[model samples]
Target: MIRHDTPSLMLLWSLLALSQAASAAPDTELTPIEVTASPIPSVAPLEGQDYSASRVDADGLAVFGGPAQANPYRALDLMPSVNLTGVDAYGLSVDQNAMRVRGIAASTYSNLAVTVNGTPSSVSAGRGGVGNLFDMENLESVTLWRGAQPADVGLGMGNLAGSLDLAIKGPTEEAGARLRTSVGGDGFHKLFGRIDTGTFNGGSSLFVSGSTSESDKWRGEGGQSRDTFNAGFAQTFGERGSLEIYAAHNRFHRDEYRPLTYAQSRDLDRYADLDYNADLTGVATTDADYYAYNSQHFDETNLLARFSWALTDDIQIRFSPYWLSNEGERRVGKTDKVMVIDIDQEQYGATAELVAELADQTLTLGYWTQRLSSMPPPMSQKVYAIDKQGGLVFSKWGILADMGDRAYESPYLQLSGERGRWRYGIGLRYLSFRIPGITSYDGSGLPNMSHDSALSMNPAVVAALSTDAVTLDEWLPTLSSRFELTPALDLKGAYGRSVGNPWMGPLYSVYMKNRKAFQKAGIPLQQLWDDLALETSDTIELGLEWRHGSLVLTPTLYYSDLSDKQVTAYDPAVGVSYLQSGVDAKAYGAELEASWGLDRHWTLIGSLSWNRNRLDDDIRAGSAAVLETSGNQVPDAPEWLAKLGAEFRYGNWNLTPIARYVGRRYGDALNQESVDDYATVDLNAVYRLGKVAGMQSLEIGMSVVNLFDADYISTIDVGQDDARPESIDYYPGAPRTLALSLSANF
Candidate 1:
């Protein structure tokens, strides 16, 4: 049968014909592109590896490399089941356009807990923010959890759905090394490679990667660019254990775009240059005087040691200890704009976990500890950098010594038993926090003299603690059960209660804390107000999965009753932005997913979800606005979401095209202004040719996002007096984008 992805099929046929025409002169081997790279010819699950759920490597569709986005998570922005929220200015930098399954995030971007081969994507930021997305070039396989969580995993802040894991290739997977280089659309270039070799009793792997890229900011007033470096290694130690170590560094040496007022967008080009305009409206057409800004510069290193002891054939135990260190600095343009310079930061921490299983039951325990410190120069020495460039330059002025140390231990006791076809388990977790204060960054410069202003201030935090230090916490308990009603039908349910301790980031505003320091110097102290309310919630999930001949389906229903919800508030009196205690809230939703094997050459998959959540009490932050829309649909939460796609394979050919839909969402929780819904389409393909051509593989693919140009708003900031809901200004989604890429293997 003919395929809907005719273009991909055509490419596949052409490639096969080309290979037939080329005659190879006999001595060297030619590699195929689609063949996966792995050195170990024999495979077995490594003992003590905490591998669990696997995620679909749906991101295999990206085509663009370098200058254009060429990574997996970045390419899946329009994939089905994903509600990537941000659309307007600095979408990548904002946390709103996050990834989740059934509306449940992995807590911070890295916390989602899917273990493939045994590593989880770790994010340096918290749930309220985003950092550099994972680099896809280093991955061997990517898989998302189908929903049944493993026995050894736990979630404290963001685990409700499942997790996604990636299994990177080991040196044993390949006997030699491979390297690639690319240059592209944005002023971008990158070089990366991997090498593997086997030695006495085991194997070793080494990898090095680096890239630099930048684009003229859409607003034309700044440069949206970046540079990055990552390197790592993994090795085995006889039969006793295996160890892996890695280090990564990223620098967002780009320009900062000040969020604009509604009025600004109405007069300037979407992302234009402002310097050419005779009038200054704080808006650029396509080109303008841009600032040299630096927000996050990080140096992170990690080490993992896995050990196991076999007590007997039926019983065994394993322990894992890990360590991590993070150091970064932020600097806004000392030129055209006054920016926040992150000149002070150095953080370190470690975590450990142990697992044991006897018969059908399993027991596990985990503990985590952390420390953070940052010291900034005094403000009197840094106000000149903010006026002309409007940079977040104030970041260089605050200091914090939050002898930050937080520790938590959760132990799970699981019992496996069947009663009339029912299997169940009970779990109890003891969690706590002792995080000291966190530093804040006030983008807008502050007046050295006493003055009343509305702004978000980075507060200086100089305190320390140990054991569950960030959020207020107590012990938590949970229960889960499942019933196998029939061979093809199973029902599972869980109910639990958890709390979120206020992360140090929201606990102290450096600007507010420094007010006392300023007042001591004859300056007025900003009036300060902080909310320290821990969120306590009850959650229940009921789900069912059914499998028939060629089809598998699953449906899950969830409800959460919450109190003291946390949300952002900008204070005008002290010019600070802080997360304050909020009124009660309720969230209820349901998710449905299905995958069908139409035939050996084709398969169909789809997912849909609906949500209803709102605040029960009023909430307000800063001079931004009063959030009095009680019972209003939550901001950034859509009422309906759906995505459908199909995959087809013929010989060495593969083709996939997907469609996704997002429902209308309230732009603001307190206002009637709204963001319209949108639909996007994408396509991708890959082919392999090694069986007849020796040991070589080649892969070429392309994808088009926002296939149809759709005008939609990602975010809207209209609270300032000069801006209002009635304004036509908005942050626009991207125009149609096309990407292509090629890869070869030996």
Candidate 2:
């Protein structure tokens, strides 16, 4: 669907054309400015990244505390253009947490990519908790890209919105041990320990860590529990080569919270305590609402390695390989029966790059490939029906498929250079996908439904479907440049194209539920499957950074034109929601961040962002009706966001407080069913104990979440942007909670 003569290309070329004229001017050397004081948890564009990027390190996570073993998304809540919502204060609920970047939700079709140490994790495909693998204590840095990313980065499934990468802190050079304990309201308890072997003979080190945590839901009868273990080993190979290997395992179980309707959100005092029934009524229909019947369990393990060597002083090569194993099950109590979904899958991938330094320029050739079990959900799910007596019966298969040559591959080349006051990079990447084909079977009528029993039973074949063997490929190009306009001022611009793989969640859902309807309407499922296309987005951005004395400021503006954007729309003939493409969208926004050191004891930070995302046109609702959805704002995308915070330091005591505001947003495509805006304040304070109890250092910390006891809607569960008002569900924000922790280092 993309053409070289499009206006998007014209606009990009016009801006890039200025680079040729500017390169002709004589280059001048500019002096760098030095700032003595800055805030502890600060956000600013990364230097030399050639994009709208920001990074936060360990110090930032320490100053902005909520949970001792917080997830990766929680660590990035302080960054600009990031909105994360969780039903619990500690971010313990894996299924209830949601994140959005630049008006695009992370779990749906409009999604961004997430990586761990520059490699994509299989758990990040859907609404999975991939961040739980490495907690804040083990993370070295988290980098965020809001616009265009370099060719060397990994884009899992999609990157139309943005991308985030978490870097792990490997084995330390010194031998030491650390211990931590925490206790909080609602029966919360956690313990963490780590031991580092330090560098020994011939430059080698090893480390291991483990944690156990549990917490009770504030407004429900159930709770959440989790256990995690991580280990790493590193060794140096002379002076030009090094190797490091890391492994992580995590398991968790949690009871889900009941969702409320629009009427319930209008009056919180009466419906605030509404939840799943604590005890079963014994009646088959009533027992379906039992709290214990609606829960989930997940267990995942990952192993990754990195190898690097220098063939020569000017040339180097690197390789990264990873393996993932995941298995889980979700049980939800329905009207008359309990539906259980079981999943088990595995994935393997690697990335290789060759770099050469030529004079003042650098050239890189990179290739990445992965053989995945499946796309997105990344699991073959089987559905079951359970009765009130706890007797399990096979109902139907949610999704069943074999790995038939399903793989992803990308090759890229980039050239970058810095000359005097100008820095520039040009790159091109080719992405190709080999979607798997699937076959459906009629299993509901079988007497024996176990995996082994069902195979021998040989249930009738219902239908065979697939995206065919067609290999979808796209050519994406990027251009970026940064110019030092003055000694203390710099200007930056970037242009790139990003794409998303076809979403199969809705497609499978509709096919399983309404296969007969397709036949009645004289439509072929194969035709519908073949019609799916990859979503694409073209973006352009301009920004500037200025520094003076003890203060720094950055402002940016960005525009994105999306083509064939995926959305779940209703099929009137079948009376169901299905995956649909070819929806055009336009998003434009502006962001600003500032930091100032007023004095030796006081440092302040603030940020503001505004986004306007809308549909460019309307589409057919049925055979004869038009939806009239043009010019409507995207659902759940808040237009305005603001954050303010300050840190105060005095001797051994340090205190920080921050407040965040999210503007109103709609729940449906027509801009109806609006949600109210809300603000919450959080505080963190830490005290150093110097040397005590024969330990090198000791510290005590206290954290307060939602300090004001704010009562507001935290997230909306509409399933899709085009959902009707009656189908909308809301989750209330948690009230004020307190947590205290103690740590010691030896």
Candidate 3:
């Protein structure tokens, strides 16, 4: 258990004991101190292919700032063709953060495949997503792919946009312990510690880490808190095979910041400090806006294991299996009451990969499969009444259901070779999806009761209803080539196809609301579901790389043809809106990145990108009416983005400053509700203290985020391009904040 009341005092006592012990010990050789320049992000091809990939190592993450070091999504803010935004300095608000790669946005249902240590992760996009699972201190590097990915890399339900791979640091061979603590603006405080057990007995090593953090909202009345624990063990079997196991648990709770309208965001001077109501009124309707009523909670646990063996000198096999358990609830204040949304999910999967060396070429074959089960279908809602004493009273069930079993399968193969100055590769992947049917309970007229109790009271078949299942499959292929023009220059190109899962959440909601209407019309709802197809994209890209003594430059261009995109359609027979997959889209973009080492003490990196994602034709709103969306850009997609950063080191001090700009964007499909462009700057400084209290190393860091305090709309919550103005939401960016941290290695 964590001691929340006196964390600082406990750490101080521990350090004092270490200091007294060191003073009495005999003289000994101290570890050497290294003050090297910070590492810059590397934007290069992947495995001799032309895919635009970027990698940020441990040092690179440090240069991005302490917040970036803690948040994986924030670490990609300065990378080319990526955008990330949040409301808190520490990125603890999981439900409010937003991320976009290229022109694709990631929301509750994102189309980006995210993985950790080569295993599928973040299967559910809501409630803090991937950031809540592991601390950045446990990560060695983060790699991102912008365009079409290789056959073996993208392994999940959605891969149409991109993929993010996180590599965790393994147990070290030497025994050691590290401790870190930080205090920042808005009553923020955090403590983290890790211990590594050196190889013992035979060839086994173990590691354990834990952290506790809490912070007050920058502009609101409430705060956020989180606790995490991680453990791992590894063993080597005489160099022929290895086994590893890892486990993690996290619990997060936060009071969300309220969003504003387009007009409200424009008047920053008057509305910058506006937040959720802190005091409740006697009137139930007025008290519905209370800050305590609008809060969220997330609790999750995960376990993963890997085994590898070498069959021969030319062949090797590896298998990884993972399991995840997640439960969360979000409470929102309504006009007269509070609504609670709950999710309980369990996911289990495995991946087996084999590699063989044949002649001058390398071949890889892999298969991946996963099963997801939801006891109460994700996002199920319940209503509650507020008592005069400000307590919650159970009202009624808003949505209740048990989702059927969902399964996925994929088998992929890839081969690559290098001949002379030309290198090439070809790959193919087959994907299959089985969407779960749902069994919904009739709770409209019933009180808040357990599932078993409700069923027993009803004692009739009319209490529950079930739907038919749907199955879909697709084939994806990839081809890539590279030609060396000179020792310092190279040309590369690639072509691939990718797919995205359909909008199932909205579809299920529509069906539940209109089940009787569908039955009356002699439509089983499966008729509409059977017509739904997965979104697919075929992309082609070309690029060139130029490298010199102290500078590296790369430029890339890509175009994509998208089919069966998810869109909303109005059905007059049911007099309701339903999700349909028939829209087509086209996207094209260009990106350029440059890195230069000005001198041994300084390094600079800059990037610029221009993207255009537009509709190919008009959208059908009804059987006879059409929405004029042709030639219009997608909502929330910026046309231009630019970033610049520089790092300088002198003796034991290192300073880094970065600037970013986001171009204008529209809020609706009709090209109305335009948002203005904005720019912001940030600075971070670190000073090495060598050794203290017998510790091998010590460092102090200071960071100032949003240095200029520029006010702008950071994220817009609009799922549909043809959304109404009242439904669109605008979230303001975080204000200027400061943080200080201390780290020690013993």
Candidate 4:
């Protein structure tokens, strides 16, 4: 059904058309034309910033061999010192999706700050809730700053790791529409469409797009479904001034999958979920029924507006305002003491920046502020009893658990200047946190007489669980500088101090009405809060950059000291988990990246990273015992990582192959259990069809991931009590997969 020589014929026709246009006569009566001088290269080295950064443009994004419906984070894995695991080619059915930077370990709260169009996108500490909010079809580029965040970036928390910025695509100058469809293994399928309105109505344009996707689990017993929409509008006002607005909404639902222990994974059939029969009793059915009766649902909406104006020939001003809302819930089986966790949040923020040219130097001043609040309604849990059929039986009435209003206000200021071969900048950020109050009631939204009677019977517990209004404040600062060594090289360094505030989940636990239950289990409630402290880190970095005609190389070395690191420890006596600030640690590493353009049709890219981390003090499990983790390598910190890739293009076809290697890692702070290293290869190809049967443009592509089908551990449950042989701690990587996609533009 296809011809190999058709591409050559199309190319011949295009050359003939261009030649004919060149031979046509020009209009002699037109006024003389004027030419303007060319501007400087946009990618040139900056004078005032000292940090490791990378950018993946639209053209580079197209070469990724992952699934068609994969999230943006999947592409970031190619960058230096970045790793993501526990997802298939489609980036769905994630059992342990975790992202780490440098040598830092992933946590319940994320350490990285993620943003879209200069607006914060991450709603929690450990994850980026907005990573899947927009369709990839509408993205222009993704930029990552690895070590120290820029002064102008506005994030209330989680900036200690780094930052990721997503820039949205702008409307095209010409009107057009596009449709795309994809299919792959594991019953995966997706459909997407977009429309762009050309410039009209006094230099204004608009675009809108939507997509839907669904896929069967690659190796588990469940599946995932997602729907998303995006819209944008841009308008030009006064000379050298413009305004733009963007909005997005997304909904996601998926079944939950738990990890497997090393012993259980020996039997591949039992790697994902445990099997159980309803007729069994007294069989400890928690793990067996977890997968069958657990699921999660999420809904989010984002709105942002940006404005830019040129006040004079050498002065400019910019402003951006945004609003976001999120609603999420997780449901579990009735066998557990807790049944559900519901979250509702609202956030709004604004940023203003001014730039001026004075005394042959560029100066910048900016301010950012935001308000965030989380207000969830009352929650309840019921007592469960097993029936003869092995099903859970619960009473109609349930106990109440209400989380009160918690809010925060963040403001920051930054100043920077660049002149000749020198650049410098400094910034300061302040945070004000408030916890108002807490309340409790029955499942029917009324006072629980039984709970009140119990509290009266235990007066000491009542006094300990009383809520109080509290406020906390913190300050952070950063300084950076750069100097040019020669026309082709530069030297840079920076020093930064940042803080990580305790998330609301842990703070709210201090006022839990069920404190008596935990105390009875030997997890003293007062001890959990007595040692709580804000996490802080100081970092120093030095780097070198060299650039030539078609090659660029960068190498960076850095060290970080962390104090009062937040950690969670298991209490075997209570059979529960408690939070504490347990240890001080240090991390040091080197990152190297290079790119060479062999020719117009051949290119090569590679990167290498080496890291080392260790605890400076012994880890204390509780007041009476110590884990003896002093001088031990931090868990989950890999010593070496490498990536290599090449691209080739000829006529209408393009091909790329990439390889990644990960070194061995430990699963516990004491280095008792080690996970083996692994490597994977991926290949991708694309062909373009020009002006085929009334279609303006058409493209077809195929991708193969994990070409060798390597078996490896995708991620480990860090800081686990490895002494327990039954602890499910490892997630298996996905097997080899193939996918195909097609798109048409008109």
Top candidate (TM-score): 3
In candidate 3, the residue pairs with backbone N, CA or C atoms under 3 Å apart (3 or more residues apart, or in different chains) clash, namely 94-128
lDDT scores for all predictions? 0.46, 0.73, 0.76, 0.63
Kindly list the per-residue Cα lDDT of model 2 for residues 1-746, writing each as its tens digit: 00011112232243234333433445433323233455444555665786888887776666563665666677667667777788888887865877777777666223677677878774554544343776567778788887677776645667776777878899999987776778998878777767788999878999887777788878868888777777889999999999999998877777878888878987888887788777756576776777777777777789999898999999999898998877766677887677665555577888888999999999999988987663343234554565656555666665544335457899999899999999999999998977766555555555534444554667665564334454667888988999999989999899988876777666766776787787677666666666777777788989888888667788889998888876666677776557788898888899887777777667777778998888887756656666666888787788998988787776677778989999998877777778899999999888776555445566799989899998888877766556666678788888899999987666
Model 4 lDDT per residue over 1-746, tens place: 00011112232243334333433534322122222322111122222357666776666666651565447666666677876676556775432466667766433233566678877764552222333777777888777776665566636445666777778898777887776778888877776777788899978999877777777667556667777778899999958899999988877776655556766655545554342222234343543254444566667789988999999988889898888887765556544332554545667887777878776556667666666655322233334444445454554334344444445565665666677888776777766655444444334423333433433443232334334545656676777778888989988887776555554344335336446556677554344544455666788888888888667777889898877776555455554445556557787899887776666666777788998777787655655767677777676667888987777665567677889998987767767667778899988888776654445667898888888888777776663222222443677777788889887666
In model 4, what are the clashing residue pairs, if there are any? Answer: 109-125, 109-126, 110-125, 110-126
Q: How many clashing residue pairs are found in candidate 1?
A: 76
Where does the lowest 10-residue lDDT sum fall in candidate 2? 1-10
Report residue 568 deviation for candidate 3 (angstroms): 1.4
Ranking by lDDT: 3, 2, 4, 1
lDDT of 1 at 601: 67
User: What's the lDDT for candidate 4?
Assistant: 0.63
lDDT tens digits, residue span 425-500, model 1? 6656555544343323342344532211212244332222111223445555666677888999888787666554
Against the true structure, what is every candidate's RMSD?
Answer: 9.5, 11.9, 3.2, 8.7
lDDT of model 1, residue 576? 54
Candidate 4 Cα errors over 4 Å, as ranges: 1-49, 93-95, 106-108, 125-131, 154-156, 265-292, 333-338, 375-406, 435-466, 503-514, 517-531, 569-577, 622-624, 719-728
Q: On a 0 to 100 scale, what is the lDDT of residue 599 in model 1?
A: 71
Better of 1 and 4 by lDDT: 4
Q: RMSD in Å for candidate 4, one decimal?
A: 8.7
Number of the candidate with higher lDDT, 3 or 4:
3
